[model samples]
Target: MAGRWVKPEVFPLFAAVGAVVGLCSMQLVRNICTNPEVRVTKENRSAGVLQNFEEGEKYAQHGLRKYVRGRRPEVMPNLNKFFSDPK
Candidate 1:
C-alpha cells in the first residue's frame, strides 16, 4: 500500500508569487550584509604610507648622486685673470 501525497490548497495560490518575492528579498538582504566583517589588517592598511616615504628618500638620494656627479663646482676660481677672455 502506497501513501497518497496531499498538496495544501494555500500553496497553489501563493507559490509562484511568494517564491519570486522571497528570493528577491533574500538577494537584497544578502547584498546589504555581504561584507559584514569590515577589517583592516595591521600590515595592509598603513604599510604603504611610511614605506613610500622611505623609498622616496632613497630615490631622491639616487637622483642627487647623478646630478652631483654631472655638475660639480670646484673649490675656487681665480676671479682676476679668468675675467679677461684670451682672444
Candidate 2:
C-alpha cells in the first residue's frame, strides 16, 4: 500500500523541475560556445603593452645612471666620427 503513487501534486512538481533543469543546461551550453568570458588576443595585446612599458623603464634607468655618472654628454656624437676622412 505504501508503494503506490499516493500524491498527484508530485508529478507536476517533478515536471516543472525537469523543464527548469533542461532550459538551464541548454543556456549553459549556448553561452559556452557563443560567448566566452576571456579573449586570447586581448590578453596578448595587454601583455605586449606591459612588456613595452617595462623595456622603456629599463632604458630610462640606464639613461639616468649614465647622467648621474656624467660619463656621456646629453647630445650623442655625430656618426661621422667613425667615417670621417683621416685628419
Candidate 3:
C-alpha cells in the first residue's frame, strides 16, 4: 500500500493557524484603509503639513470605538436587566 504524505490529524491545527493569520491580515488591511492618520488618496497625500490636524482629530476614534464609547458596560446586559427587574 502507498503511504500518505500528510496525516489527517494535523488538519485542524493547520486550519486554526491559517484562520488566525487571515484575521490578522484582514484587520491590518481594514486599519490601513479606514484610519484617518494614514491618508491614501491623492488629494490627502498632497495636502500641506498640519493642514488638517483638527479634522483628523475629529475622526481619530475608530468606528467601533466611537460606537462603544456611549454604551453602558455590562457582561450580559439583557440577562442582568432581566434578573434585576422588580416585577
**Number of the top candidate by lDDT?**
3
Q: For model 3, how does the per-residue alpha-carbon lDDT over 1-87 read when each residue is reduced to its tens digit?
A: 334535788679879999999999988897687656676888987874655666576657667789899899987999999999989
**Estimated TM-score per prediction?**
0.27, 0.35, 0.48
lDDT by residue (38-60, candidate 2, tens digit) is 22565554654343556455544
In angstroms, the error of model 2 at 17 is 0.3
What C-alpha lDDT, on a 0 to 100 scale, does residue 44 get in candidate 1?
A: 50
TM-score of model 3 vs. true structure: 0.48
Give the Cα lDDT of each candidate: 0.56, 0.59, 0.78
> For residues 31-80, what per-residue lDDT tens digits would candidate 1 score against the true structure?
45432232256555455544355645554456457777765375444553
For every candidate structure, what is the RMSD over all alpha carbons to the true structure, in angstroms? 29.2, 28.6, 5.1
Q: Give the TM-score ranking, best first.
A: 3, 2, 1
Ranked candidates (lDDT, high to low): 3, 2, 1
Off by over 4 Å in 3: 1-5, 49-87
- In candidate 2, residue 31 scores what lDDT? 51
